[model samples]
Target: MGSPNEMVYIVDDDSTVCDALSSLLRANGKNVRLFSSGAEFLSFERGDVGACLILDLRMPGMDGLEVQKLVSNQASIPVIFVTGQGNVPSTVRAMKGGAVDFLTKPIDEAVLLAAVEHALEKDRIARCEALQQADLLARYHLLTPREREVLPLLVSGLLNKQAAWELGITEYTVQIHRGNIMRKMKADSFARLVKLAGKLKS
Candidate 1:
């Protein structure tokens, strides 16, 4: 069974295929959303929810690859492509676009289920990273201008006296700022503070 909050979105033009996939996923304690075309799926607002998309490679209006490109820049929902007439070129393009998996028509239920689980796990990890980054940024914004000035020098392996001289402040003032930065960033050690700075810089 997949996570209750995690959804599996299915976008295929064939009604029978969509229905069968939806039922199978739902029966296995997974949430499912079925779309008849890529456009319909794109129109839905999926903001920060952990989910994976099962997209058909060929469809009218907009194809799966087109949708994948668009979403890759947005929320980056993990994609698993399902195609009735998949070709080498198409599969290569999908893989390059960060697709989780590609399955041909008449896909085995076991294979499809495994792919969906993998995609959902990818989404979960991405969501966690996003949340952690947001938290780090929020903490960083709480820093004072002087603290911000001290941070780079501290992380760059500068001694307190050197950082104070660079910032035209007393060594005692630099130590005070360092303590504040550590407390505000919730970093327990000098190494952890350096790591947090790296994440912020990246």
Candidate 2:
């Protein structure tokens, strides 16, 4: 699950549009942070949490595309483009730039809400995968040298006798190291251990 404080950041120079969208989201039990411009939004600190950005495409100074580039470099924040007058070229640019959804104003409440939900869910899954990868790395780091040496062969479906022979150890010692590997990795089964190793490989 994402942090309870996770928000839908709304960046629009229009005060009315920002307020309306903020209120709409807040009414549906979503946390919101309203920013008057792209520059203002870029100043905020980000973390490994799930949230989406609703940005006006034609904002003054740094536009939405520029904001998307900046945010993409800093974190994997999904963007939704909102514009009063969207052109084909601009919409194409935003989509190619990794905007999850492009919305034109006056926004439909249901459509906007649905898009936000989808973006938030995507962010949630991404954050979870990142956390899982980090945990796997930490577990991998905890393995002893012998256990580490055994892991590749174990994940390759090697039997205890084969792994023992390959490592110049007895089958009994191979079994012992395998147990330690499983414990350190918090892996319950051979399949789980293989999956963890695959993630580490990636």
Candidate that scores best on lDDT? 1
After TM-score superposition, the amount by which residue 108's alpha carbon in candidate 1 deviates from its true location, in angstroms, is 0.9
For model 2, give the 10-residue run with minimal summed lDDT: 1-10
Task: TM-score each candidate.
Answer: 0.97, 0.88
lDDT of 1 by residue, 74-181 (tens): 768899999999999999999999999999989999999999988999988898999999999999999998899999999999999999999898999999999999
Ten-residue segment with the worst summed lDDT in candidate 1?
41-50
**Compared with the true structure, what per-residue lDDT tens digits does model 2 show for residues 1-202?**
3347577999999999999999999888898889999989899886545699999999889999999998898889889999999999999989998989999899999999999999998888888888888988999999988899999999998999999999999999999999999999999998999998998989
What C-alpha lDDT does candidate 1 achieve relative to the native structure? 0.93
Off by over 4 Å in 2: 1-4, 47-49
